[model samples]
Target chain A: MPELKTKLKEYRAIFDMKQGELAELVGVRRETIIRLEKGQYVPSLKLAMDIAAVFGTTVEELFSFE
Target chain B: MKKKNNYRNFHIITIIVVTVVMLLYFIGNIFPDNKWLTPVIIFVYLSSTTKLIGPYEKKDELTKINLGRANGITLITVIAALFVISLIGSNSDNKDIFASEVYIFTALAAILMRSLLFIVFDRTPESLGGDE
Candidate 1:
């Protein structure tokens, strides 16, 4: 299976954001943010876009398949 | 997150309560009458289905995915168990294995499996990867 590597944690850190805050902004559960950061989950396009938008980045820049 | 946790807790509590009630009924110590067994069994089945199919707008995509996976696994497990029980009933002289009590037991087991599996899926990581 393709692994979905993410820079979600780094982005959150840079933004000084909490997982719960990011989740709220993206309209998801905090656990979902944790999973994405751990690369344990692959977000949908809409979620990816939302998260990227929150961090002022593009989805391609936030996530990559390995 | 709090809302999701509450929803999860509600499901776990409901399943546990129903399972305990069904077990007590099966033991025949608390309730000697079988009049309420059918209604209780039906309630369990309906509640389980509702939990699986009800509105999940409060849940995220990952949670929704996990829920689907859990329900799928529970359905297969229950079907396999019933098949085995039916086989046993057909080949053995003890046809009482196909009794209403057994159905109730199966329903309880299915819901319990679904709830546990959902928790497991929700907590476990999905695949091998790391934050970059």
Candidate 2:
């Protein structure tokens, strides 16, 4: 599978949210968010949607196929 | 943080309990008169690993994944040990090839099976809906 580059950190910073808070909003552990930010883990479609919703953007805007 | 600490404590306690049970199981093997002890030990070992216990039964997806990985690793370790035993059996003219150890493999495989099922079913839509 192609790697997904996430703009999670950028959006998170724009929203001034902590990793744990974002994780809580997205219904996942903080480590999941941390790994996602580091590009070490891929989010499922539902999780991706949840995260994108938290940042008030679409999944395509938050993540890029690379 | 508090929840994480509790999980750590639970794991520590579980390790101690499992260690004690394993030690007692081996000790029971040396005493043929106490045949009941071994079965009880095996029961506890199987139940704990299979997540029959409350804390483990309530594990999250990440914890379930870790448990599955642990089961896979432990199954590999058990298989390696069995191979070594078989080699010893060959060298020592024991044609049985450590037949008794098959019980251990069966137990380990059962745990691995349970872990695999947990990993698979935990991600299902039903389980997610049930969580809510």
Candidate 3:
């Protein structure tokens, strides 16, 4: 199975958004964001879009499949 | 913040109460003379409330999905266990135990499994909402 590599931490830092802040924006728990950034869990389409939108980037820019 | 504290407090209370009930069941079985204990156990089972274990309306999608998976696993386990239990009960000469008791035990096991899985996979309440 291909794994998704996220640049979430970098983009989030660039946007000055804490994990909790981003999670709230995406309507999910902070732990979900943590798991996503750690590549331990995958997000749904809606969640991926929500997260990307929060960082003002496209999902392709935020995450790469490897 | 207070709500989160209350939720944690509720969970602690639930664990303590469930532990006591299980201990009573164990002791009652070991020392059969405790007729009074049987009634107590029945009362505890009958009056049991699932305030801490009931489904929540506010769980996030990830948490909900994890919970669903946990329930599916628990259900499969219960079905497999009941098949084995039925076989054993039929083979054993002891007929003292009723089918209802077996069903109750199965239900309790399922609930316990679900609760354990939920606690293991779930994050702190603080992570679910507004930041501190």
Q: Which candidate number has the best TM-score? A: 1
Off by over 4 Å in 1: B1-5, B33-57, B124-132
What would you estimate as the lDDT of candidate 3?
A: 0.68
Q: State the DockQ of every prediction.
A: 0.36, 0.11, 0.25
Higher-ranked by DockQ: 1 or 3:
1
Lowest lDDT sum, 10 consecutive residues, model 2 chain B, at B123-132
lDDT of 3 at B88: 83
With a 3 Å backbone cut-off (N, CA, C), the pairs that clash in candidate 1 are none
Of candidate 1 chain B, the 10-residue stretch with the lowest lDDT total is B123-132
lDDT of 3 by residue, A1-66 (tens): 999899988887788788877876787767777778877678888888988887778989988889
How do the residues A3-33 of candidate 2 rate in per-residue lDDT, one tens digit apiece?
8798988898899888778867766666556
Regions more than 4 Å wrong, model 3: B1-17, B28-57, B122-132
Q: Which pairs clash inside model 2?
A: none
What is residue B82's positional error in candidate 2, in angstroms? Answer: 3.4
Q: Write the per-residue lDDT of candidate 3 for residues B1-132, one digit (tens) a residue.
A: 222221223334445555565666667667777768646754654444334344322467877877787788888999899888877888888765445756766776676676666666654445433233
Cα-lDDT of candidate 2: 0.62
Choose 2 or 3, whichever is better by DockQ. Answer: 3
**1 or 2, greater by DockQ:** 1
Error of 2 at A32 (Å): 1.6
What overall lDDT goes with each candidate model?
A: 0.78, 0.62, 0.68
